[model samples]
Structures are given as C-alpha cells and as structure tokens.
Target: MTLKTEPFVLNMGPVHPSTHGVFRMRVVLDGEVVTDMEPVFGYLHRGIEKLAEERTYGGIIPLTDRLDYIAAMSNNFGYVLSVEKLAGIKVPERAEYIRVIMAELQRIASYLIIIGAFLNECGAYFTPFVYMFREREKIIDLFEMVSGQRLTYNYMRVGGVSQDLPEEFLPALDKFLAQMPVCIDEYDRLLKENEILLARSKGVGILSKETAINGSVTGPALRGSGVKWDIRRADPYSIYDRFEFDIPTGSAGDCYDRYRVRVEEMRQSLRIIKQAREQMPAGPVRTKVPHLVRPPVGETYAHIETPKGELGFYLVSDTSISPYRIHIRAPSLINLTVLRELIIGWKIADLFVIFGSIDLTMGEVDR
Candidate 1:
C-alpha cells in the first residue's frame, strides 16, 4: 500500500549560501521533489533609482557601481551610455575601445565567479572555485592597475571613460590575455565532465526557449535557452559592431547548457578583447563635459550585455544637472520571473544547482 503525503513548504534563504545573496525561495515539497516555488527578493534594496534623481549626472556613476557589483564596469557602461545619448555626447574612438576592453574583462571576471559558485553549489567542494578565482585575481589586478579600485571600478563616464589607460596597463593586459585561455581549458579538464556534476546539472531545470524570451531573460541565461539574442550583437552598442564575436547558444537549456554557455562566452570575450587590443587606436580617452551636464529635455535608453544578462538604463532628462526620471531594466530581476516554472518538477536538491546556473546578483535584483 502507498502512503499519502501532503505538500510541505521549505523556505531557503534571505540568508542561505546558494541564494548567492539576500534572496529567499519559498518551496513546496512533496517529499524530495519541488512541486511549487516562489522567489522572494528585495532584502537588499537600496533605492538606487530614487537616489539617482537626487544626484548630478556625473555623481550617478558611482551609485551604478553598486548594482551587479560583480560586473560594476558594465553597470557604469549602461548608465553612461544612456546619459551620453540623452546629452548628445560623442565618445572618442580610443575611449570606445577602452570601454569595450574593460567591459569584456569584467565579463570574464564575473563569469569566473558564476562558474565557481555554481560548482560549489553542485557540491564540488571549493576546488573549481579556487581555480577560477586564481585567474580572476589576475584580471582584477589589471583593472586595479588602470582604475585604482579592485571591485567597483567606476571607470566609465558619459562620452568616455573617467581616465585614460596608464602606460603600463596595456602590456600587463597583454600578459593576461595570453594566459586566460589555458586556465579556462584547465577548468574544463578538471571538472567539466565529472560524473557527479553532470548527474546533478545535466538535463536538470530546463528553461524553454519561448519561456526565456517571453519572460524577458537575457545574456547567457537567454542564450542557454537556445535564443541568439545578445545586446552586443543585437543592438550593437559602442564599437561592438566593429568587433566580431560569436553568440553562443545551447540545445537543451538545462543547467548544464547554461554552464556551457558561460564557459564558451568567456572564450568569446577573450576573442573580442584580443581583436580590440590589436585594432585599438590612440586618442584622447574622454571628451569634455561640463560638471553640470544638462541634457536637452529628452528621453533615451541604452543597454549592454553584462555577465548575468542585458543590463539597460532608461533616462528622462529635463534640461537639468540631474535626471527627471531614471529606470533600470535590470536583468537579474527579469530573469527570476520564470524561477517557479523551471524548478516546479525538479528534486529539492537540484533547486540550488538550478538557481546557481541562473547566476544572479542580489544588488541588481533589489536595485
């Protein structure tokens, strides 16, 4: 005779390891399987949008640094581009190249954290995390050499970067570019085919292509769902059109495919950086803009492909030093919309593995 069981709810996080940050998951479990789920967020909200209205256009850059703090440079890129569009500011050629370089570097760095953290959630101990962080440290060192900040670079500004690359920066970057591919391969060799990781991740928590697009997911998560939409390729921000890179996609849209998409994206990011370094021209890194940047009363939207997804900034300027209104089309928030659908039928233990594959940053979600 079969025993009857009622659904039981399990609340994980708002302060759990696999939530990544202050995020909560309300799960209804029928024994070991998840029958329904609700993603709870806003535990780390800082009112960044409300705060942007109170600050000058230039002052808003630093605040953007906090959103998706892992890919802070990409946050800077989106906000600055929106401001530049509103103000009719033109970025210098060299600054465009520098912005691409910094953004791509941030992409690889952020992916490192994603891959490492996902493996840890999959119960790989800390081995993969340690290996990825070793390479990530080199990229961070290169960023610090130019911007003098390790985590929040605040390096991009409207119409260009805050400053030019130091003379030594390029050579050091050249060294990093030379070594990153080998390190990536080493990660693949170490854990990509481990039976346990594959058992936990492969064919698990599959997100459909239609659901991903309709849900407004972007970046690797969307790409992992077999969608070929990358803002860099789709919208052509900055000099992205000038550079050539492949949009990597996955077949199954499962946790393993998401992992593969990010890993392949790191390789593609390296390719873009290499070509940018070879083709970059020498010129002023910034264009002059007044301290009080009063854009003509207008509205504009700008977005870039961050590690997590499409990060966009929409601005309404009223011919003042501060924006009349600002809205962030945060990828982290939008990507979580399908969380319940993805995990509803999966086992309870697979929940964190699937969540980690989505790779969210709570700062952006709560912003």
Candidate 2:
C-alpha cells in the first residue's frame, strides 16, 4: 500500500548562516504553512566518543570540551563525575566548589549566546546581540584567566579540576557579577516587551508537557513546556543541593515561554555563582591519583544541568587507562527530538523562530 501527497519541499539549512552551525532542515510546505519537518545532522562528526577508547583517562577531558564547546566546564564536570565515581576517587570539597563556580559561570555565558543569537534571528539585528555579548565577554575573560585558554579549555582532570583559582580570579568574578544584573536588564528592556519579538515568538512552536517528556527533552526546553523538572534539583550532585535557587518554568510551552525560561535560568545561575563564591573554601583543586589512570571493570553514568540541558556521560571501564565505552547523552540532541512536531502547521518563517528558541548547539547535537 502506498499513499503519496504533493507537498512543496525546501531545505532550511546545511549552509545557511542562521542555523547557528552546520544544521539542515528538510521542510515540507503548503503555501505558507509547514507540512512536515526533518532535521538532518552529521556534518561535524568528530568521532570523539570512539576516540576516547584510545586515549588515556586523563587524555579524554580535553576531548569532552569539544562536545558542547559552549558549556565546556559542565561537559568536563559530568565526564569527570562518571570517571571519579567509577574509580572511587573522592574530590576535595574545595575542588567541588570550584567546579560548581565554573559550571554556573559557563551556564550564564551559554545563555548569553542563545539570547543574542535568537534576537538576531528575530530580525532585531545587532542591538540585542551586542547587549548580550557585552556580559558574555566578561565570563570568557574569567575562563581565560583560570584555564589559560578560552574556548577549548583543557582544564578538567579525571579526579578533579586541573587548576586552582588564580590570585585575581575571585575579585574579577565579583566585579563581573555586580555588573551582570544591569546587563541582563538591558537585554530585558531591548527585547522582552518588543512587539516584533513577541508576535514572532509568543504563540509559535507550542509543545505540551507530556509530549516534551516522551520526547526526552530536558533543560530549559522541558521547563519552557510547563514541566517543573530540573535535573539539578531532581538529581542533585556535587553539592548542588547546597544552593538555594528557583527552577523557573513556563505554562504555554511556546517560543515566548522558552525565551522567558532561559532568561530566568540565567538569573538563577548567577545566584548559584554568588553562593559558591561566598562559601568558597581554600584547598587543593585536584585529587591525588596515579599518572596512568585506570578504573576497575564497571560502568557509571553522571549527569549535570548544563546550560542547554541535562548533559550526561555514560562510561564503561574494563580496568584500562581508557573507557571501554563512552556514551554522551547530550541534552541538545534530546531537545531537538520534537522539532518535527513543532514546525508542522506553522509558517516557514516560524521555522527560524522555533529553532532559535530551542537553542541548540550543533556540536552536542551531532556528537
């Protein structure tokens, strides 16, 4: 049996600049309405997971950084958590606080990118984008100071972090924190109530709570869809339970809701950063371990709340210096699970708005 229908077909991306990265959308349209959508990936398959088997335990940390490339510290933290649990390594309290600080700071930085880029896609041009970056640059400066490198930070180790907080790090971080709230407000004034942004995003790309769960969506995407679920709170790890913050969620699960959820999430992350900085203790950054790191034959799955969503690492060890199997359950990939459903029955222009609202990173999605 065969059922065929005529639908105007077109490609959304693969080489388009607005895709944010190497992403292709196969779109079926009827006049101005979308009929169906399929996302195509694999343009940037670096094979890092398979390569992890060949590298030593210590060698894989830097490779994890390339997975998300946005929240590099959170990627590093999740991988190290699985490895540490597998090897029975106890990270010092001080190191854990440092990890939390870095993770939260990176989370804020990641949201800044999303807000700026999403506004740009909404056709607000450079005004909002520039406003978002002004705060993000300060966070990047903090990363550079501590890690000795910015984007591809190789500052994570299996047992713990690779470096201690620099002498100037805390004071600089405090200054950035004091200045960030005003910057976030500036972004609010620019796009929050703008009729253009609201009209484009408010009712577009609605996803229900139940559907969001079945699709395995996590992070802000799930929250935006009216699910008050956060992996950080649901499955607290690495002293995250110690922090006091609210999980901001939405009711309509539309593009506007997604935008609002992430904005509130950025504010929550800032709160976590302040708490971590105020309660920081002085101690060693990394745990003592052998040069040739190996874990007993076992498996461990460690998950953390990355800026994008629940970033998890599944590691199986066979008592070798490298993992026998590594599975990166990236939230960006899971969040894209519902793109087809959201794009249907909408205008082709809404495709741009919906994708931007989802806030995906091609690195994690394709990984």
Candidate 3:
C-alpha cells in the first residue's frame, strides 16, 4: 500500500530570529521540502518615503538612517548624494575623501554582519557570529569617534559629511586598516575550509546570472551570480573614480559563492579605504547652503553601492524646503523578488541559509 501525502503551509516568521528582522514567509511544504513560498513584508514599515515629504532636505538624513539600520552610513550617503544633485551642490575635496573612507568602512562593517548571520544560519552557531561582531565593534568605535552615534549615524550631510573627521579619527582608522586584513585572514583560516560549512552551503540555492540582472538585484547578490556590476565601479560617484579597487564575482551563484564574494569584497573595501586615506586632503568639510534648502523645481535620482545592495533615492522638488515627492528604490525589497525562485524545492532548513545569503534588512524591505 502506498501512502498519500498532502502539501501544508507553514508561516516562518513575522518575529522569528532567522527571518532577519520582522519578515514573514508563507511556505507551502511537502513534508520537509518547500514547494512554494510567499514573502510577507510591511511588518516593519514606518512610511519613511511619505515622512520624507514632510521633512526638510537636511532633516531627512535621520529618516534614511532607520531604513537600513545595519548600514546607516550608506543610507546617509545615498540620500545626501541625491539631495546634493537636486540642489547642484559641490562638495570639497577633503569631504569627498572622508565620505569615501566612511562609506568603505560602513561596507566592511555591514558585510561582517552578513557573513556572521549567514554562518549562524548555516548552523555554525554563535562562534563565527561573535567573531565577526568583534571586528565590527572596532569599526563602530571609529564611526563613534566621528559621528558620536553607535548606530543610525546621521553623519553625511547634504553638501558633504556633517563635519570633518576628528583629530583622532584618522589614526584610529589607520590602525583598523592595518589589522583588519589579518582578522579577515583569521576568519578564513577558521571557517573558510570547514567541512560542515562546505556541506551545508556549497552547491545550494543557485541563482542564475540572467535572473539576477532581470530582477534588478545589485551589490554582492548580483555579483554572486557572476555579474561584474558595481555602482562604484560601473558609475563612479563622488571621488570613487579617484580610488582603485577590484570588484569580486562568484561563478556558481550558490550560497557558498555569495559568502565568498562578501569575504573578498571586505578586502576590497580595505583597499579603497587605504587609498582614500593616502589621497585625502585638508579642506572645509561642509559647503555653506541655506538653513533650509529649496531646490529648483526639478527631479533627480542618485544611487550608491550600499552594503546590502544598490540603494537609490529619487526626489522631486517644487521649489520647496521639503521634497514634493520621495521614492526609494530599496535593494532589500527588490532583491526579495528572487526568493520564491531560490527557495522552492529546497528543504525548510535550507530556506534560512538561502535567505540569509541575500543579506537583506526588513527595514529597507518594508520601508
């Protein structure tokens, strides 16, 4: 006699730890295998775009901080770049180098979170997670020296950074740059060739290159699928054209490839920061502008290679202090478009690894 099986739906989260942040997944399962999945968003939405319309251009920087709280510096960079373009503001040379250094440091810090969380989801538990955070804390200390905030640093301003790096900031950053590569190497020695990690992640949840580009995935996720596209390299912004760094790509497009790409990218971030440090000159950090910026009636969009992915802000001005309309092309939400394609037919346990590989923060997704 043959037994009959029926598919059942399991709700993964709106509050579970593995969902990253208040995200939900309705999974159609056949026993332990996921047959279909629907990602549920909005649990964390705070109408950030709508709120931007009510705040002045300068005031909106804090709101962007809450979008991708893990990489708040990148959020600030993207928004300020958009506002500067809208107002035709020119940033100083020193400020541009400072921006590059901060942005690159933010990229490294954000990738640490992703790598740690991904390894944790793969069942390495807190060992790797804590190790990653140890380095991240050093980066955070450097940010605090400049921004005076541990998280949600509202550091980037409309013209440039809120202020020049403090007297001690560069020295702290130089120390970090010197020691970070050794730490990265230590992480590699510990887990890069672990048998268990290889078994769990390699050759799992592959996303094709064509699908990634068509879905508009960016950053490491797109690069993980063997696409050699990076906003910093593809379309230089600020003084990114002045720096030399390599874009890392993965061939298999699997969980392991994504993890490897992030690790390699961290090294590249260090390279960029080192160059910025060597090239940075002394000048005024912020350009003088009206207390309340009222751009000419026009619209502009600016995108940056945020740690999670490509974060773009589109602003429309009606010659007002506040934005006439604000729209965010949040990578967290866009990258989720490929979830169903990646998770279906995999075991429920594999779902976490695949999802974590994308490195999304629900704040950006639901915002």
Candidate 4:
C-alpha cells in the first residue's frame, strides 16, 4: 500500500530566525519539498526616502547609514557621491584614497558577517559564526578608532570623509591586514572542502545566468551566476580605477558558488585596501563646503560597489538646503527579485541555505 501526501502552506517568518531580518516567505510544501514560494518584505519599513526630503543634504548622511546598517560606510559613500555630483563638488586627493580604504575594509567586514551567518544557517551553528565574527570584531575596532562607532558609522561627507584618520588607525589597519589573510586561509582549510558542506550546498539552489541578469541581480549573486560585471571595473567610481584587483565569478551559480565568490571577494578587498594605503597622500580630508549645501536645481545619480551589491543613490535639488527628492537603488531588495524562482521546487531544508547565500539585510530591503 502507498501513502498519499497533501500540500500544505507554511509561513517561514517575519519573526523566524532564518529569514535574516524581519523577512517572511510563504511557502507551499508537498511534504519536504517546496512547490511554491512568495517573499514578503516591508516589515521594517521606516519611509527613509520620504525622510530625506525633510533633512539637509549633510543631515541625510546619517539617514543613509541606516539603510544597510551592516555596511553603513558603503551606504554613506554612495549617498555622498550623489550629493557631491549634484553640488558640483570635487573631493580632495587624500580623501579619495581614504574613502577607498574605508569602503574596502567595510566590504571585508560585511562579507565576514554574511559568510558566518550563512554557515550558521547551514547547520554548523555558532562555531564558524563566532570564528568569523572574531575577525569582524577586529575590523570593527579599526572602524571605531576612525569613526567612534562600530555600526551605523556616518563617516563619509559630501566632498570627502567627515574627519581624518586618527593617529593609531593606520597602525591598527596594518596589523589587521597582516593577520586577515592567515585567518582567511584558516577558514578555507577548515571548511572550504569539507564533505558535509559540499554535500549540502554544492549543486543546490542553482540560479541561471539569464535568470539572474533578467531579474536585475547585482553583486556576488549576479557574479555567482558567472557574469563578469563589477561596477568598480565596469564603471569606475572615486579612485577605484587606480587600483588593481580581479573580479571573482562563479561557474554554476549554486549555493557553493555564491559562498565561494564572497570568500574570494574578501581577498580582493584586502588587495584594494593595501594599494589605497600605500598610495594615500597627506591633505585636507574634507573639502570646504557650506554647512547647508544648496545644489543648483538639478538631479544626479551615483552608485558604488557595496559589499552586497551595487548601491546607487538618486538625488534632486531645487537650490535648497534639503533635497527635493531621493531614491535608493537598494541591491538587497533588487537581488530578491529571483528569490521565489530559486526557492521553488527545492527541499524545505535547503531554503535557509539558499536564502542565506543571497546575503541581504532587511534594513536595505524595507527602506
């Protein structure tokens, strides 16, 4: 005799642990396999774009920090770049180099958090998570030295950084750069080829290159689908053109490929930071701009290769202290366009691993 199975509906979370941050997925399951899925967002929405209209251009810097709280520096970088363009401001040479260093360091730190959380979702639990966080904490220490805040660092300004690096910042950064490679290698040696990880993630949750592109996915997710597009190389922003680094792409676009891309990207970030450090010059970190910046009546858009993906900002000014309109091209939300397709037909157990591999923070999604 054979037993018949019926389909059931399940709500993964607006509160469940694996949704990453206030995200929910409504799934239709036939036993252990997910037959259909719908992603639910906006649980954490705060109407940030609307708020930008009320705040001065400079004041909006703090607001951007809240967009991707995990990679706040990159959020600040992208927003300030847009504001600078609208105002026709030029950043100082030294400030350009400093921005590159801070942005690259933030990339590594943000990747570390996602990688740790991804592994934890895969069932390795807090052991690997704690190990990765150990390195992330060191990066946080360096950030704290410069910005005095571990997270939500409103460090970048319209024409440059808000302040110069403190006396001990470089020495501390040097120490971190020296030790980070060893830690990365250690992580690779321990988990990269582990049988359990390979079995769990190797060929699961495959996203096709065409699907990724058509859906407008960017960053590691798009690159993991074997696309060689990186905004730093495709469209050079700041002093990224002055640096030498390789864009890492994955072949199969599976969970393992996305995981591998992030790990390799961390190494590339270290390379960029090293070049920025050696080529940095001494000059005023911030350009002289009015306290209340009033750009001519016009609009501008600026984007940067943030840790998760391409984060872009669009700003419109009407010669006022505050912006007339603001819109953020948030990668976290854009990248989720293909989530339902990726999750459908996969086992319930693989759902968390697949979703975690995308590496999205709800702060950006709900904004």
Name the top TM-score candidate. Answer: 3
**1-367 per-residue lDDT for model 3 (tens digits):** 9988777989999889988899999999998999999988899989999989999999999999999999999999999999999999999888888888888899999999999999999999999999999999999999998999999899999887887788998788888989999999999999999999999999999999999989998989899999999999888888888777889999999999999999999999999899889987888999998889999999999999999888999999999899999999999999999989999989988999999999899999999
Residue 116's lDDT in candidate 1: 96
Model 4 lDDT, residue 52, Cα: 93
RMSD of each: 1.3, 2.4, 0.9, 1.3
TM agreement with the true structure for every prediction: 0.98, 0.97, 0.99, 0.98
Alpha carbon lDDT at 299, candidate 1: 91
Clashes of each: 0, 0, 0, 0
Worst ten-residue run, lDDT, model 2? 154-163
lDDT of 2: 0.88
Tell me the whole-model lDDT of each prediction, alpha carbons only.
Answer: 0.91, 0.88, 0.92, 0.92
Please provide, for model 2 over 1-367, each residue's C-alpha lDDT reduced to its tens digit, 9 standing for 90 to 100: 8977688889877988788789999898888899888899989788989999899988888899999988888898898888888899999888899989988899888998998888888888878888778788899999999998889888778777888988999999999989988878977887789999998899889999888999999888899998888888999989999999999999999989999998998889999999999998888888798988888998999898888888888999999778899999989889888989988998887888889899899998887
- Sorted on TM-score, best first, the list reads 3, 4, 1, 2
* Candidate 4 per-residue lDDT over residues 1-367, each given as its tens digit: 9988777999989998877789888899988999999888899999999999999999999999999999999999999999888889999999999889989999999999999998988889899999999999999998898898999888999888988999998998899999999999999997898888898889989999999999999999999999999999999988899999999999999999999999999999999999999999999998899999999999899999998899999988899899999999999999998998998889999999999999899999999
lDDT of each residue in 278-318, candidate 1, tens digit only: 99999898888887999998899888888988888999988
